[model samples]
Structures are given as structure tokens and as C-alpha cells.
Target: MAFFGFKDIDKLSEVDMAIYRYIVDHDEQVPLMRVRDMAKGAHVSNSSVMRFIHKIGYNSFPEFKVSFKNENQDLMRSQQNILNIFTRDAFPHDIEKTIKLVAHLMLDADNIVFFGMGGSGAIAEYGARQAASLGFNSFAVKDPFYPLIAQLQNTSNNVIITLSVSGKTSEIVETLNNFVNSPDTILISVTGNIESPVARIGRYALTYNVPETRIHKYYDLTSQVPCVYIVDGLLMELHNQDIERQK
Candidate 1:
């Protein structure tokens, strides 16, 4: 197979070659698996896998895998390639799966509550706003303690959507520890790390593997843009679901 999308397969470094070979070997698999697994198979690190994907013209490992499998070949091939323009395009990553997951959760939910701190908190608010516009009952609680306590009461069977990219924010971590066991509430975590504590606590977790938009790396709030995009996409699906339900 073509390594790194070019004829110069031998030009790649050992790390890149390992990742490339792994992708080619597993390109036929269905449902697309994680880069972590592939890296493990190659006995390489996750960062090395990501670098390999980037070297191969993909923005992220997820994008690379999506193209590699060609399982949804028509949809994958037909769509326009999305390129990130640094500050202009903000969320250059495609978070469609995360949105779809949230939509499905909302479809069966009685209520929805959002939790986050700092920029993730803003994302929580954005999600609440979008859900509200769709006539869904929702709240974005920036103050952590009340929401945690509310979950314990079990008065409403709401879905608690926690926005924590790293999945280790103090507020989110504490909230999960306090509320994860609630019988009436379902925990939905939108985070970058699928293996983090928040994801572990969540009833459903939508994991984003974008290392490029490291929100915590800088002082700016741009990292939260991905969360906003995800919330918006979820709202679109929720609107569709509502229309279907009404019809």
C-alpha cells in the first residue's frame, strides 16, 4: 500500500513506517477501531501513532482511520475534505459521532443537565441553550455542588452531560464521584480521553481524540469550540428526532 499517501513509502521514519504498515494491515476491518489499539499492536506510543497519521495527510487518527477502512466508502469519499485554518475554522475536527451519541441520549431522556468548569463550562452552557431551543428540558450548571446534590435526590431521571475534554477537571471528577451511582440519572460524558475517570463513571461517553486543539495548552478559550460544534450537531439531530416524533 502507499505509505503516507505518497509513493515514497521508504522515506518515512521507523515510527511512521510502523504505523503505516499497521493501518494497511487492518484497513479491511469494520466499525473502525481506536489508534491506541493499533499503537499497541505496533508496540508504539499513541503520540507516535498520531504523528504517523499527520504525516500521512490526515488531521487526526480518527480521520485517517475513517478513510483507511473505506467501510462507509461512499460517504467518506463523497464528503469534501475539511482543512483547519488555525484561528479561522476553530473546530477543524469532525465531531459528528459525539453529536449523534448525545442526540440518541436526549431522545429518551426526561431532562438533561450539563456540567463543566472554565471553557468546558461554557460548552455546557452552549449545549443547554441548543437543547432548550429544541424544546428539550436542560440546564448548564457552572456551579458544581448543586447539580451533584440534585442528582442524588433522584427526583428527575435526567441525563447528566459532563463536558470535560481531558476527562479530569476537578468539578467534573468530583461530580462524577458523587453522582455516578445515582439510579435515576444517567451520566453522559463528552471528553477527549475515553479511559479517564469521567468516562469510566459515565453511562455513555463520547470520546474525542483531537490532540491538535489542546485547549489547556494555551490561555485562549478556543479549545471549547469543538464542544460547541458537538452540541450544535446534537441539536440538529434532536430537532430531527422531535420532528419525527411529532409526525
Candidate 2:
């Protein structure tokens, strides 16, 4: 895939390849170019430009241009050494599956608990609030004792959503291990590291590809945008599903 997750040019026909190459080479200008103008520049017909745009997964030229501009804007904003830009884009890749799974879990659970520590704790709180707004029984719990109490009170029909950017937080890992044997409890972990211990313990894992920086470990420069994106997306899906059911 090219930048912004566009299909590889090599997969296109000869004519479409030329048009795609023109777009890539003149990305800054293509977003503003009319179909006829782009066709003329690429030595193709206007219909061919439309076909290429649709072939690239957009409904129309305007849609394609909007996505192109948004991707470029993200790049421009991240030029100042922000790693979160890349992480932000990662959310959309597996969004459909993640949202579906999370929404189902939320609907099925009697109670939903959000767990995290430090920076992740804030994200957990925000996620819980978002879920609550969608009418789910959700709350963020930072104190380990609270989770233990909740687990003891209601072991079955409960869903736990945990956030750990590193996916290796000892406290999270231990907490997960405490409930690993509970077949009725569903654990969902959101993390940048899919293979880390915390992710492994979860029943479902939502992962974002963020480069781990040592600076992030000490100073907390890592972007929580991906975590927030996943939480928001999941809540939106749940809301949409509820609307559909009502209709």
C-alpha cells in the first residue's frame, strides 16, 4: 500500500497506472485538480480519471480528493517529529472488526469496567465516560482494589476494557492473570504492542502500530490518539447499532 493506505500502483491497469503515478508525483496539486485537468495531465480521458478514483476505493473524485487532502494535512502537521501521526492512521485499518467485537461485548455485558494506570488511566476514564454516554454501564477504575472488589461481586457477564500503550504494564498483567481463569468474564485490551503480555491475556485485543520510544517511557511523549480513536469509534458503532435496532 502507498501512503494513506491507497492501493499499490502496480495493481492498476496501464492507463490507471499512469493516472495514479501522476497523482502520486503531484499529490499536492492533484487534490485541487478537476477530473478533466487530472485526465489531461495524465494523458487519459475524464471517464478514466473517474474510473481510477473508484478503483482506488473512493466513491467519487471528490471523495478521493478529500481523503487525499486529509492524509496530506496529517503529514504536514506531523512533520515536527510527532510519532502519533502514524498511530492515528492505524485506527482505521482494522476499525470495522474492532468496533463490531467491542460493540457486541458492550451489549452483552451487565457491567463494563475500564482499567488503566498513569496516562492510560486518563484514557480509560475518557473511554468509560464515552461508553456511559452511549448508555452502557461503564466506569473507569484506577485503584486495583476496586477491580478486585468488582470481580468478586460480579465475575460473570462482565466486560473489562484495559488500556496500556506498552502492553507490558506489570499491574495490568497481574490483574489480567487474576481473572484469566474466569470463563464468563470478557477481557479486551487496547495497546500499541499486540504481542505484549497484557494483550496476550485479553480475550480481544485492539492494537495500534506506534513506534516505541525510550523518551516516551520516561517523559510520556507517546500519543494516546490511537487509544482515544478506538474508544470513540467503538462508542459510535454502539450508538449506530442502537439507532438501527430502534428503526
Candidate 3:
């Protein structure tokens, strides 16, 4: 059978219960505390501590401490994320101008293309569906290797919306740069970095100004909450403008 689960209170003996209680109550201290200290604090012997360590499936104290520290970091990061994200002031100072510009572009565009990757890719899909629901010819291209959707014609009446937390994705920057200088084909990028390549190339860039976050070297765990807010704001602006025209 597998070792006693953290929640297996019934399976935990009295000594195990003592160890579990001390660890939970002193979580922040346990990672840094010595094994003998843990035993002393838990009111158990050192051998009891070893038994509890194996009961929880860790072969050694250092191994258990590493796992505990990672969990602690995750907990702290999650708490910080919740406490710090999404306030009215977190939006761009010139959001009014950006929204109006996006609205104007959508009204004149033949089609809307949204571009992004990973977490931002999901946001691109959402933006396309939302814009389409508002009566725009909208589609999302998440694949970095997608074939040319259409020729890069000046005044082609096309608009592309890009979502990138860093605004540094090479495929998006290279593809959009070819069309940014042309008239009637607008590029609107939503990013956290104003100076990033994609943002620099955009006709209009809306930024959230949040710090980038990554849980690992290759994976970006940055908050996309601001991107969602900006896209919704833009689509709503277009929707309201369309309503005004009808009346």
C-alpha cells in the first residue's frame, strides 16, 4: 500500500499525529528547522520523526525539506497573485484612446486576426469569438507556423490583435512588422511590456504594466488577467459604437 496520505488522519498513529500537527502549525519554520528540532517541537523522539518522514514517503529530511519549500513557495506566490492583480489603476493611462482606436479599426476592417501563443493563445481565441459575436469577421491564428492568411496589401482593410505578456514573441513580431507600415491594415497589441518588439511594431499598443512571472525556466506563468480585461474593453467599445450607428 502507499504511504499514509497527508489527509489520512485515521491511519496516522499518535506519534505521527504529533509530527503532522507540528509541521502544519509551523510550516514556515519546518523547512528551515533541523530534524532534531522538529522532533523536539513535535514532542516526539528523533526516531519517531524518521518514522513520520517515511510514512509520508520521503526517504530523507533534506528531500522532505525541498518538497516542502517548493510547496511553500507556490502557496506564497498564489497568495501574492491574488492580492496584487487587477485594480482600476493597473490599466494604461491612455486606455480611452486605445479603445476608441480599436473600435474605429474594427468598423473599417474586412477581417480581424488574433495572434498569441500558450496562455496568450487561449486569450486570442476568446478575443476572436467575442469580436465575431459583435458582428465582426474575426478569427484567431495561434499556430506560429500558419500559412499566410492573405497577401500583405496596403489598405487591405485587415486588423490584427496580438496578445503577449512580454510582447517579445518572434513569430508575431516578424509577421506583423511586414504589415504595420501599410495603411488600412492595423496592428493592435496588448502586452505587459511597452518596449517589447510586438508592442513597438503595433499601430496602437495597450499595456497592463504588470511584472512578468515564471514558475520555471521554460514556462511563463504571468497573469493574463489584464489581457482579458483589455480585449473585453475593446470588443465592448466596438459593440457600443455599432449600436450607436444603428440608432
Quantify all predictions' global Cα lDDT against the true fold.
Answer: 0.71, 0.80, 0.83
Candidate 2's residue-wise lDDT over 1-247, tens digit each?
Answer: 1245764756889998898778878989977899999999999999999988877788877778888898888877878664426744675476678778788888778888889988889988988898888888888987655646555465578888889899887777888787787877788988888889988887888888766666745766677777888888778887888787779
**Per-residue accuracy of model 1 over 36-150 as CA lDDT, tens digit each:** 7887988899899887767667686666665655544554465545444224233324545556666877887888888887778888888898788778888788876664674
Q: Least lDDT summed over 10 consecutive residues: which range in candidate 3?
A: 1-10
Question: Candidate 3 local accuracy as lDDT?
Answer: 0.83
Q: Pick the candidate with the highest lDDT.
A: 3
The clash number for model 2 is 0
Q: Model 1 clash pairs?
A: none
Of 2 and 3, which scores higher on lDDT?
3
Tens-place lDDT digits, model 3, residues 215-237: 76878978888889888888888
Hey, what RMSD does candidate 2 come out at? 14.1
Model 2 TM-score (2 dp)? 0.62
Which regions in candidate 3 have their CA more than 4 angstroms from the true location?
1-83, 149-155
